[model samples]
Target: MRLNPYGEDPVRLATSLTTSPPLTAEELTARCVGAGVVLEQAATADDLAEVNVFLGRWLRVVEASNPQARAALLNELLAESSAYPRLTDHAGDGWHIHYRDYGLPVARLLRALISVGTALHLTGRGMHRLSRCELTECRNPFADFSRGGQQRYCSPTCANRDAVRRHRAKRALAS
Candidate 1:
């Protein structure tokens, strides 16, 4: 069976958008396609504006202080964006389930895809799977797809930077 497209990929796309927001509709469309999303239509300026709005709300879900708060915030997105699961061959690879209505505009499609994908990801993985990078200087959001669910940084660069900082601090303290 094909890996569930409605889960990890959408969350990753959401994280990317939060990390480096696209400045134009064409740019947003490019980013989505790069992230493996099939936009139902060319992204419009409204789609660009509204996607920024949705990502702001999506960040609230990422920044929630606790699991309950996270769930509550994600649920609000779900309530606002999702619909009953429907089987789709829209991509024509094979039939699969989609958590949104087909033929939605780009922004609305993204809102649905990310929200439902997030719900699936958290439920299937763990509630703690969504988080910000641990490094103080780079607090970008990341989905913890690590098998152990122990991801603490957005990238190895951040992890290495934080480690070096800690090592230097310890050396200073010892000296």
Candidate 2:
């Protein structure tokens, strides 16, 4: 069985892009390269602009009101971005499956990767796996890679903060 390239990596990359977005095309290119994504072309200013817009749509998937809404939004992305499965050996790493066509620009490439990756992550894990932090101050979106499927915050810092807050509230109520 082949491990599809569109898996956990893209969703996490999508989360990172949506959370602390790159300010420049070079930065975006650097981030993608850093994340182990093969660059078909170097990102340009236009690519950065396009990706920013695409990320807004991606965030909608994260912020959907319910499971159906979430699936609907993600379906929109999948329909708009991904293509029929294709085979590739990008960088000669070995033959693997790709969901987008060859030689796409950075913006389109990212859209395909993020959309397909998010779908795989949600379907394989749980719909509840993709979510924003529960902490009101920091609503960062995260892909819950937890074993228990009970992630509510974007990070441990936010989780611990909320826990402390809850504990303090309970103590105050007791007092």
Candidate 3:
């Protein structure tokens, strides 16, 4: 069964793209396809440029100071990118819901998908679900799709490093 693209997956994709952005349209298309996004149109230079712009706006949503701010930023993205939800089988996989108008360019499709997916994620989960890594040195954004919803670091490596640092600090204090 196909996973819900408008849930955790797009959030994860957003975080992935934000963390290590593609340098070219081809690279962007490769990454999106790897993340299960189907690109009906050819990826172009304009698509790359547009995606860069969209990512900047998406970052604001991630970095919002409060839920109200987050909602406002996200709403702006949704307004700019998404349309009324409709069923589509553009990839011929099956009839699935799309939050964008048909036949958009690659960048527009990504913008619409990511924006609406983020909205669904924040509303369905908690507003605090999207955040940067708690480790101060690594500020990579992440979507907390954990069952417990308590993810703090972007990766286990960062989490382990922080834990080690905390342990060392506590040991030093005791000594």
Candidate 4:
């Protein structure tokens, strides 16, 4: 069975939802579709609620202070969401491994996908790869997909903003 390219995308998707959550099931589904997730079932308000709950739990995993803590949290999520891996080309997009059982509701599918993807990302990259932005006032979480794995901000804007703030503060102190 081929593992889906669950490296960066699922983490990024989870980050996006946590940083700026969609308000409706349609919006959430649209965002998932936009991110190239295949949705075989109709999204509903219940799905939205479920996603919110799942993301909340996911955020706990993200905020875990150390590798052991993170791993434990992730393991719990994995147990809840995913199953033994299997291969499928249900979408016809390509043959890939699925960590979830077939015919799950959209909410459950997302939980499984995100949990497994986050596991792959952290273990494949580094345990410290996922983190909140370093910007003092902007604490959005992010996935470090940078070539150097040194990404510390959720966006370039936040990085630049913090940089400018630091520069001005330094100049003022120097003056």
Candidate 5:
């Protein structure tokens, strides 16, 4: 059975992009491909700029505090980059779903992918599951797929840093 391509992968890809944006079209395309996107067009500088704009808007959705506000923001993104859902086997990976039409530019593809993926990720997991790391110094956005649904830090490093800080604070309080 074909896995849902519109789920975790896109959200993770968006997080990665937001954390460290690509500097060039080549780098952007490489990152997308690395994240499981199959590109059909040659990426251009214009595409990179367009994607940066989309990412800016997407980051707003990530930073939104309330569910209603987040939904409104995401709906706006979907309206901007939406197409009729179509079934495609362009890559012969499998007969899967595409929320966009073929031949769209790379930026448009990314817009659609991120919008749909975020929606799926929130609904499938939980709306409260997506958040920035709780570590005061690291505000990286993360999609929590943890079994307990309590993930706060972006990675183990952040978790460790926070733990060390907490330990130091306790020791100081004892002194």
Candidate 6:
């Protein structure tokens, strides 16, 4: 069965790219493919540049502190990359939904995927689930898909670091 690609995967891909961006068009294509995005067009140098621009805007949605602000930012992105939704069985994969029409270039595809994926993530989970890591120094964005929706750190290492810091602070205060 084909899984929905418009949820956790795209958000994770966005976070991964934002944290450590792809240095080349080939790298970007590989990263997207690894994230389950099938690129129909060849990734060009200009596509990489355009995608970086989109990523900058996409990160704003992640960094927005309030739901209204996040929604507004996301709406702006949707407006910029808006396309009618359609169903397709491309790649012989079972019928699945796509937010953008077919035959789009790689850069445009990223915009639609990231924007629509983000919308689905926030609406399906909770707007609060998308956030930056709580560790002060590590500002990576993450989409919490855990059962409780209470994730704070981007990774276990950051969580451990924050826990240790908190423990040391408490001990220092007790002394």
| Per-residue lDDT of candidate 3, residues 1-175 (tens digit) | 7666787778888898899999988899899899888877668999999988899899999999999999999999999999998987788888888899988899999999899999999999899989999999999999888889899999999999999999999999999
Per-residue lDDT of candidate 6, residues 16-118 (tens digit): 8888989999999898888889889778899889989999999899889899999999999988885888888887878889888788888888888889989
What are the clashing pairs of model 4?
A: none
Off by over 4 Å in 3: none
Which candidate's lDDT is highest? 2
Candidate lDDT values, in order: 0.92, 0.93, 0.90, 0.90, 0.90, 0.88
Worst 10 residues of 2 by lDDT: 1-10
Q: TM-score for each prediction?
A: 0.97, 0.96, 0.96, 0.95, 0.97, 0.95
For TM-score, candidate 1 versus 6, the one ahead is: 1
List of clashing residue pairs for candidate 1? none
Per-residue lDDT over 50-106 for candidate 4, one digit per residue giving the tens place of the 0 to 100 score: 999999999998899999999999999999999998878897867888888888888
lDDT of 2 by residue, 24-102 (tens): 9999999999998999789999999999999999999898888899999999999999999977777787898899988
Over 4 Å off in model 6, which ranges?
A: none
Checking candidate 2 for backbone clashes, the offending pairs are none
Off by over 4 Å in 2: none
Q: How much lDDT does candidate 1 score?
A: 0.92
Model 1, runs deviating above 4 Å? none
* Models, CA RMSD each: 0.9, 1.2, 1.1, 1.6, 0.9, 1.1
Give the distance in Å from residue 174's predicted Cα in candidate 1 to where it truly belongs. Answer: 1.3
Worst 10 residues of 3 by lDDT: 1-10
Q: Please report how far candidate 3 places residue 71 from its true position, in Å.
A: 0.6
